[model samples]
Target chain A: MRADARDNRARIMTAADDVFGRSPSASTDDVARLAGVGIATVFRHFPTKTELLEAVLTLRLERLRERARELSGDAEPGKAFFEFFTQVVSESASKLAIAEALTAAGAVAGAEAQEAGRGMRSAFNDLLTAAQRAGAVRTDAEFPEVYALLIGASRGATAAKLDPAVRDRMLTLIYAGLKPYA
Target chain B: MRADARDNRARIMTAADDVFGRSPSASTDDVARLAGVGIATVFRHFPTKTELLEAVLTLRLERLRERARELSGDAEPGKAFFEFFTQVVSESASKLAIAEALTAAGAVAGAEAQEAGRGMRSAFNDLLTAAQRAGAVRTDAEFPEVYALLIGASRGATAAKLDPAVRDRMLTLIYAGLKPYA
Candidate 1:
């Protein structure tokens, strides 16, 4: 692609991210206006709205994977795991609207997004294994359940009238739950 | 209300519950037809989709409250609390689509629902207090945090591909977290 075309593509993606972050149902025209590009230009690069959404999610998921890799080498596995889980919760909440929109559009029906989800899950499993090996977390529980709990809590936080302090409390409880028995 | 009119209303609510249980966005006409009532009669009774949703949730919430009350009187406060929490989680998952629809339509924002939510919170608080007093749960954590964590776990269960056994294990971990320090 030409430099100018690449720039337009990047600009459209960034705008779509912003617009869909706010209103998941934002139209292609909204993305075009936000990107300061013509509708035809927007359609030229991305044939369909679903394609645009998938691209945006792909970008976000890539960033999330990068962050997970950075956290993987942290000194304390338990702390690293907790911090990574917290970050995932916060970041996932931010992108949840867009994910919902993409799912609704039937764009995420295949293994493309599934592979990304699996990558994140594997990162979490590694953290869990490290923590259990260190005797910091209980051995009885598995990774998927822990991840599911964290994800659920994140979504509840979005809906409930909770204080920031409450989130910390929730983290403490989760940490406590993960502690090994005497 | 007339006897036949009351019967029609009950039938409509039951049918709405069944359809919405399957698909939250089931059309009013579908519900009316399922109830063997004319669309005009359904409209006459409900006036709006939101009204119909509220009617269904109102019935469900009443049943939820009754269950809470029954659990409160059970032999083991801790066991009862866990059972009650599990029931809430299961119901929430099963009716999530309808709940979302009700929330979107602003039916759940009514004063009645708010009061009911507060009542449920208080009921959970009472259960937590009883369990703590019985030395079955931790005294350090607040009741609201416990409720929030359970809600979060339920939300997580909705998204994750968790097996029933894995879910049970996760709940066990949460219950362990709620226990007093050994």
Candidate 2:
């Protein structure tokens, strides 16, 4: 695409993300307005709302995948794993909302996004394995269990609608739980 | 009330609880069928589905409050708190489903259920305070934080679709996180 067209596309995606986050039932016109673009421009870029959602989800997953890859090579495995866990929990909460909206809007994740998710999980598992080997995490810990804890901590934060200090406490508690058994 | 009438009410409530648990969208007819009573009889007792849900939630919360009070007087504070935590997490998962369903069905809790819930939370906080005083739980932990952890861990377990062993592991992991610094 041309440079101006590329800029418009990026703007549309970013605006759509914000609109969806603020209101799951956002309309294309709302997204276009937020993007400072006309409805015609949005349609020119993406033919359908499902196509737009699919594009947004794909972008989010790919970003996660990229971050995981960058963190994969860090020398301090324990710090790397915990940092990644925190990042995933905080970020995934909103990303998950978008994913759910996509599904509700009848826009299933295509193969590319599914592959991105798999890649992200595998990198996360690698970090966990390294952390466990360093005796930072409990020996009995499994990657699936770790992922569950991440989701749990995030869920806890949402359920409690915790204030900042309390949210920090919850996250700290999650980190403490992952420490090697006493 | 007559003995038979009391028996029928008990039966209807029990069956309603089960029906709502397995299927949040279950109809009153479904509940009556489960209770082995006529639809007319169910309506005679509850007047409406909201009334039935209020009754069920009230009963569940009262049972939790009773258990909490019993545990409060136990000599072993650590055991009491941890056991109560386990009981709440495991049992409340199903109860939460009913609660959510009730909300989705537009049934807000009546004052009675709200009072019962307050009673339960207060008892739980007392248990936590005792445990912390015993040096079994961390000092910084708050009641809301603890509740959030319980909900989070429960959610993680469900979202992971964990097997019993992994589910057990998730609970153990949450406990590990709750301990005072090693």
Interface RMSD values for the candidates, listed in order? 2.1, 2.4
> Candidates' DockQ values?
0.62, 0.54
**Per-residue C-alpha lDDT of model 1 across residues A23-57, encoded as one tens digit per residue:** 76889999999999999999999999988877777
| Accuracy of chain B in candidate 1 (TM-score) | 0.85
CAPRI quality band, candidate 2: medium
lDDT of 2 at B175: 84
Candidate 1 chain B: minimum summed lDDT over ten consecutive residues — where?
Answer: B98-107
lDDT of 1 at B11: 95
lDDT of 1 by residue, B98-125 (tens): 3353233233455565555556667777
- Give the lowest summed-lDDT range of ten residues in model 2 chain A: A98-107
Q: Which stretches of candidate 1 lie over 4 Å from their true place?
A: A33-39, A93-95, A98-111, B33-40, B97-108, B161-163
